[model samples]
Target: MNLFSDIRTLVIDNLNAMVAEGALPDGLGFDNVTVEPPRDPLHGDMATNAAMVLAKPSGKKPRDIAEALADKLAQDPRVSTAEVAGPGFLNLRLDTSVWQTLPSAILGAGASYGQSDMGAGKQVNVEYVSANPTGPLHVGHTRGAVFGDALASLLDYAGYDVTREYYINDGGAQVDVLARSVYLRYLEAHGQAVAFEDGTYPGDYLIPVGEALMAEVGDAYVDQPESVWLAEVRSFATDAMMQLIREDLALLGVEMDVFFSEKSLYGTGLIEAAIDSLRDKNLIYRGVLEPPKGKKPEDWEPREQTLFKSTAHGDDVDRPIMKSDGSWTYFAPDIAYHYDKVQRGYDLLIDVFGADHGGYVKRMKAAVSALSDGKTPLDIKLTQLVKLYKNGEPFKMSKRAGTFVTLRDVVDQVGPDVTRFVMLTRKNDAPLDFDFDKVLEQSKDNPVFYVQYANARVNSVLRKAREAGIDVDDATLASVDLSGMTHDTELAVARKLAEWPRLIQIAARTNEPHRVAFYLYELASDLHTLWNRGNDVPELRFLQEGNTAASQAKIALARAVSVVISSGLGILGVTPVEEMR
Candidate 1:
């Protein structure tokens, strides 16, 4: 199904044959041999670097090896022709049947066409959207949430046993601040004036929590001291905040398999266990006497602290696990969390963090590395900021969130499909610009609409066919004679369809869901180009008057393109609209 990978195998087979014939050495390493789509479509269906990579090792010229490899490759029924081009690269043109067969494969596979086993069932723990449970998820958290959810889905499709997780920050001092804030709301609920102090949350979100607290306890804690009410209110307030975070995530169709509480690590001896595991490995130490590189001499001070030997695993410096006050640092529980994931017997770990947490990546990786003894690999992806715009001007704030734009604010206005697709229009590490006007615009410049339009156009064709009493279902068209689709423009679209499985693996392996967005756009472009061509060339149209046979084949190709688009969009959590309305 993967044409590029198949062709690479073909190239390797021919190289082995050449070695048997004594034209090349038997032991030449073929690891670097690669077959891929050439930069330009005009070059060939596929291109291989077999000659160049093996020339020096084989003690033979690249052009000489390429010519021999070309002849053997041409013997395969799938490869129609092979030619040696500049620098002895082999370009191959696959037979028309290869392109024609793709539509049938797509129809038969349906939505599972691009699903791959690239991860090989590796247990991958993807911890993401671990935002503080202080408030509802905002636009900043939305990007990470969407990116993480789509990643878990993508890895699942790629055959990874993925666990979508959220780490709650309830054990921190912030929760105490939240409790005090909600206590103010409780006092106000009792008809007493309350002023939010400097460290208390002032958002209206906590107002309801205050009222709920009053309803639950009546007047019991009306004038209670901080010790009598802080713990109870903090627990209640944290749970309520977590509920709000869950609702915000649900708005974007995100579901987590686990909601890990950082507070659990404190009383469970898990933090001590994780730190002790590192201590046993000689990674824990009471050290750290150097000042920061650029710190002023007056400001710099030497302080001995409990540290993890993160430098042993490539961190810039050792990381502190505990302060002089003996309380665990923020990074302490994080280590325990990942250690718990490692002990869960996962083969891989992936963390989806905000760009602000880029500094934590190295130490986290170091922790996972030491915990798993390098048996498990950890991949950390940082999602950058998403700048919002409206009518070409920067959108500054959200009324509901009281600070940043809430996730619901974006989803409510644009729906989940647009929000998901537009969020993945750029690389995760790169800044994304969410233009409210452009995403909804029904123009080629808007990728989301363009892709949906392609699917809608396919439906339009099927609607017309069904209305004309023609069988337009996939089963009927899949078995139709596709000889009429031999035109250059028609076959070009099929070529793009052939790349779906290969593209999926690449995107999934790189953990880059944005690649699916790019592929969908390109596939949509090819589809639209073919559709536009029908206006000028009457015979290229999908509707063939009085010729159902030819119409079925052509329509099959069009439908197959839409199927791939829908499948790709599904991977990115996008929905294909039936119509532009």
Candidate 2:
């Protein structure tokens, strides 16, 4: 029930007919043709660039092509008018009945009204919030988590086979620091005073992990040296931190399909295998890199290191994969991780990284490009910082996380739904100012509340209709005669409803789930506008005086708005409220 797609098909069919009748030249490529809403709604319902794109190719003036195309489109039953405007663009107005019947389509599709098959069931791997397994997830990781989860849901709605993944950075020195930190807490649990050093984690979140360790081992390693307990405590602490992370994510309604440990890549020959695969392709070599641009030559010393020829795959320069000491560099494990993803048969891979990882993007893409032989495409989306404010002042760090605001802190302050919605109100790469005071307000400025209120209003209409003894079930309302729904205000909402499927494809294609949030806001605005119009025009109200059939038709339109709102909110992983609380 994609009305825009249906209308576009009509335009294409008429163009093909023109070609067949020799009204236009044969073999004209129609791939570049596009049908989209006009920039100014007063011009027409939709606009197309068919004439402009085909003018040079057909050796004809754009206005001539547009005029000819307009005549053919005007003959279609769906197209009430087609007029050429501004040299070449063709503006189209559809029959009123076409918009009038959209409620039936929305009722028929229900929550699947805007679902798309654009992804064609392609396998996509989305890795996000791969925060180090050392402590609770902070506000920065929260943004990535929300963005990644919404994107996965968006792709799923668009018919992609999506797998949510998390890469645990447990094999690094940070985890060792976490182990020593936990050792201090464990000694405290055993009634010994301990001090946290500069390099050790001092957050109270680790206190429970240490107490749990004391319970498990029963002071077996209390007086032991590092060699006797480092490995055991490191493994134990990592598992505890991961458990804490899981709880944090659960608070925000996020669940990962896979948790890949960096430790698993080590001691398994996986890192060597990934590097060897590149070496076999002449990508890996031993070389001396040029001195970094900002540093003086005398301050730099060139050393032979193992490198990957990342420049061949669009990176700024070749990147080192192994150090001069023969130990695998940080990039080596990441390469192996992506190599594993490629071997798993994913058609696409998306990584949600923090803004600080901007420099890592090109090299990571190069690694996947080389590993997959340029078959699998990789997209990295970076989430920027979030500044939190409460009572018009900067929110301070949590005592639990010590130096940062944990994901749980946000979720606990506001519920998961508000946290998720506010996080996605801006683009992924744009910094967001989260004002706790403003987000919970009942005003229209709060997009989440406004959208939810729209859904609630729809339910209110349904309840009032039932109380009036009108059978306002979906089937009854969908079957009602909507021929009387010709008001410009009412039709404006229907026009927005017709754009839902089109919006889904655009957002999915661009890999931007924030577009969904923005669209939902606009849709809610349209719904709210119509609701307010009813206050002045009695005829515009959803319920008519003792006119059951007419009331059913108007109520159907309101229900359709809720249907689409529910579907969009579902994609954002937010539960659409049936009643405002």
Candidate 3:
């Protein structure tokens, strides 16, 4: 149960009662009313802006309304004190029993404690890690992959029907370049020395693909013309590269529900259909474009071309859909791809791209808006660069990837759990520094290890209780009498646990999964704070000697923290370790 929501409903009901008693005017909209933790905890447990939001509309003084509302609120058993703060802010102190019941509620819900129905089962298509299928995924792609996968999982927990998708960039000219590069490898496999000249891939990852091609058709395409082998090799090379990409994703626990091929949009009526849909709306036109702002008239090349009126749908300017050579521009296939997504009946679309793709956000949003007539909402998240370091110095690049570090390079060094958690330690748009030495350090400064250590501590508590012959299973602890759990430090941790469900809704609404990692760190801090206090105060310890009831009451709180941490880490796609090694 969400304690914050429960208290908000309590506040609203008291306001309604005040209206009925003629203490305030009728028909005041309570939509703007909010109940949240006070800015200063010294003021109260929770604060509400009910009087301030209702004053102007009701034609009453905020203080007068707050006084009347406070009286009605005081009648509730959950609220212990309702005091009017500066300018009619109502600060509330809840009864100890309210926070005391939270541990039981958390244990009862288990891992589903923070799951929300905020999305209401709306279908959401999340497209991420759509890197070119030319080689294994690099470190840049890993950030998008982790962010998108975690977002999909987060939305699912918030009750959205999420589809994890990857749009393959296999239909572009890059695939032709990949085919030529593999052809050179094929020659090398045939005992011929070859040079990887300009504009060709020389990574050793393609060596096996070249050998496989030779084995499939022995000496058939040997020394053949470009036309004879380009198409066949392009198809084969992309398939092999996609296999490599899939294996790389698996290393990080990511699996897509769909792998959409951009090639399918060509040689078919799909592109024409998408463009025609725009044409029917008068958004397509043949017009001359203006020169760029900084370009001189003499240096400009302006021509009449087929353009999409993207400006009408919030883009900066109209974009050309066809080039002067009469071939589709790069943006044409993208429009068709998103149009196909809209046609699939998804209510929402989310694209995760590297920071380099920030310029494409507005145009892609405009395309989806025009295609769906503003019926579908699209959100594009750009993951910024990750700077790698070891021992406080820049890390070395992967020899296998040729130019950059591969996803496997990071995962192999720290395992998937550390890599995933550290990637999300910063906001998606903010640059992240992934320090190898610091992340693995078993200290409070390392959030991943600190959070994992909290869970491990809870497990240790349960094991010790079980060995002491005290029943510490979830059901038994959930039913334990927690009236003795009224200490200030114990209640502090409970207050953090109560914020879980609310935090889930906020993060899901804003499409920010990084907030989950942030919340877990705070919760872990609260837990560790209480755990440390036990050393000084004998009764504060979770395992009370010779008293089963008291020990169960205290251990229940530790178990509750573990439950919430597990739930949060599950959304982040990180497995919570039972014990930190």
Question: What C-alpha lDDT values do all the predictions have?
Answer: 0.89, 0.93, 0.93
In model 3, pairs of residues that clash are none
**Stretches of candidate 2 exceeding 4 Å from the true structure:** none
After TM-score superposition, the amount by which residue 581's alpha carbon in candidate 1 deviates from its true location, in angstroms, is 1.4
lDDT of 3 by residue, 159-259 (tens): 99999999999889999999999998898899999998888888888889999999987777889999999999999999999999999999999999999
lDDT of 1 by residue, 136-162 (tens): 888889999989988888889888999
What would the TM-scores of all predictions be? 0.98, 0.99, 0.98
Top TM-score prediction, candidate number: 2
Question: What is the clash count for each candidate, in the order shown?
Answer: 0, 0, 0
Ranked candidates (lDDT, high to low): 3, 2, 1
**Model 2 C-alpha lDDT per residue in residues 71-95, reported as the tens digit of each score:** 9889888889999998899999999
The clash number for model 1 is: 0
